[model samples]
Target: MSKTKSPIELYTKEYYAACTLGGIVACGPTHSSVTPLDLIKCRLQVDPTLYRSNTSGIIQILKKEGLGKLFTGVGATCIGYSLQGAGKYGGYELFKRLYSTHLVKDEATAYKYRTSIYLLSSATAEFFADIMLCPFEAIKVKQQTTMPPWCNNVIEGWKKMYAKEGLNGFYKGITPLWCRQIPYTMCKFTSFERIVEAIYARLPTKKSEMSALQQISVSFVGGYMAGILCAIVSHPADVMVSKINNERKVNESMNVALKRIYSRIGFVGLWNGLPVRILMIGTLTSFQWLIYDSFKAYVGLPTSG
Candidate 1:
């Protein structure tokens, strides 16, 4: 008789290391490609009057600064996202395993509880990940927006901010970040798990027995659903983060700036560039899952099913 190996046996140090590295690699290009959308999103969030229409904003940016300006903060964004991706994906797997072992008993119970686990794990991971990201995010937002050229890149931005604002500079937008990320990750990870599970449950055959194509299709749908939720829940905070990250302030307090933005933009203004954001999130989430799963399969790790 053949013996079945435990899930613990499947999780090796090497597997985790690979997952971390793979996540970083997978996130780099995705972040770089989405820089333009990010720029637009930030602009609309910071100054709604100036960028009321997404198409008009894009056109204005293109006309004044040209296409290259759209990628203003690509470098910082790439670094931040790569690190965040590694932490998020690796942490999710590690926490999921821990939860399954300690909190859940039966395999069926594990599956039932997976969505909660995913939400908790991903949110926890993102909290720390965003700390690492806060400085770079500040730099990226400043660079992307209509900030002065003195803040040329992340390093310059960091130096200028520290010189002016001390340690507080790097974390200027952390409150909004928490507001954005907690809900965004909650929706992203939980929705993904729920959607995937629902798809498999509705299938005629067991998901474990499905072909690779079937698994990929399920993952795509799940990812899209998760992305959509994330985009909507986090849009306002995202705009706020961008505004705080940018904007050289001589007089206005952060609260004042926020109030100004709110007064100018209103609720719908927060959702500026949502269409592009949807595309970015949908593509990135789908690809991240596909790549991570493929890597896991290649490394002989057990599939989620």
Candidate 2:
């Protein structure tokens, strides 16, 4: 039998690629599946008067726009998240290495400050991941927020935005995307690590002795718990991202847009649509970690990598 590699050797360039691919497999399909819920979430944020509660919003959308409307921008969700997954998972692994080697001095320090390392690494990875996701997210929000007679799909939206505002148009919400995703991602990664650590610590048997399904269930629990924090931390900026992307003005800065939105909706409004989001994000994030971990196991790679 071959000898097992150390953690340092286990997470190599190819390991990162596997993690990136696993991220794509995990995030893309799961996010696309929730397009309908996400569509309603955006509508509630952008036009609360019209959309109202989640139940009312769904009924109204089905009645007025039909089934097709609920799936608006799903293509953007899949494609954009697939790309962002590469940046997020792959970059997280890369940043983890950077933090371990350059930032954390020695192994003992690394172990002592692992939580801080997770936070910094997750934040750095999410920053670049959001950059990749921003344009596609802009397209998705625009399609979801604007009613009929808007760009029909991701391709059409890309073309239209290019014609209307050029390359800069696509990146309209990068700032808010960063603001929204960074904190959310930081919470996600850090919480997941801590929760998993907690679980293994509490478990009488070693993780290796647990069944594969048991391991996956633990991952799912950690992910869902993390997602609650993810949604709460990210909701306000998420609202701003949708609003900014759908702006009608010619030259609106982030502050101008934020001020206008805050005036329109106060602190309470920022948390609108959160109940539905809790259900949606909780389930979504759980499945993301489940699928990602499953994928890694299937490919014979370390799940954490």
Candidate 3:
């Protein structure tokens, strides 16, 4: 058998661009659509005494604020996610290449070290991404949790926060953002790669010989595994994001607040809006890979394995 040139071998630059664009497009919509679930999750985390249960909190929002209110900060969610996608996917590619050059000396050792590289690269990328995300997240939280109409949009929301609380307002929940994002990105990117590799290895035919359908199926499975793990591992920090973003004040530190939220709500409370989140992550994640690959192909770019 003769060696076939890999997609990445064909058009590296185009492939990288596609990956970045696909990440933005896919994640933007996914994050926006799930804003309501996020709102409910955050509310429960901040004031367990008020929210009590996810179902009840959702119902209450619908009753008082109407269904549209649930999507209050969707615009911010989209913008924030778009930035995050660029940083995440583009940064991953850049860092992956860097690590491959400096860390992995040969194919024999690639598999063993590849996931670790992904974890490190993704976490680093997410740290910067979350900083860009913090202000938007803060505004989104305020808007979602029954803020006044004047504070409806991002600009006004930021103004209001700054006027009242100053620069510290933007960074109020940043610790939680770091906590949630670093682990989430680590699991999301690393696990996706690992799972895809494992599946391809198990296939009857060599991965290089598999059709597009097989590739997509593998992508879906990999994305699901990554999403589930990301969701579970990041739930605690997620609770923190919700709590700090929504509440005016609670006489407790961040860790104390987290413990209180968990103690009041228990394990189930930690996963308050998990059903919607799972659906959100699974569908978007699967489509993200498909879109990224398709876009790369369209642009005559090389595919990254």
Number of the predicted model whose lDDT against the real structure is largest: 2
Give the Cα RMSD of candidate 2: 2.4
- Candidate 2 whole-model C-alpha lDDT, 0 to 1: 0.84
TM-scores of all predicted structures? 0.84, 0.94, 0.83
Q: Is candidate 1 or candidate 3 better by TM-score?
A: 1
Summarize candidate 2's per-residue lDDT along 55-119 as a digit string, tens digits.
88788888998978879999999999988888887788789888988986799999899999999
**Model 2 spans with C-alpha error above 4 angstroms:** 1-9
**Model 1 regions lying over 4 Å from their true place:** 1-9, 51-56, 105-108, 147-150, 247-269, 302-305
Which residue pairs clash in candidate 3?
A: 7-302, 7-303, 8-303
Candidate 1's displacement at residue 86, Å, is 1.0
Give the lDDT ranking, best first. Answer: 2, 1, 3
Say which candidate scores most in TM-score: 2
Tens-digit lDDT track for model 3 on 78-161? 988888887787778777777767788876686677878888888888888888888888888777665443377888888898
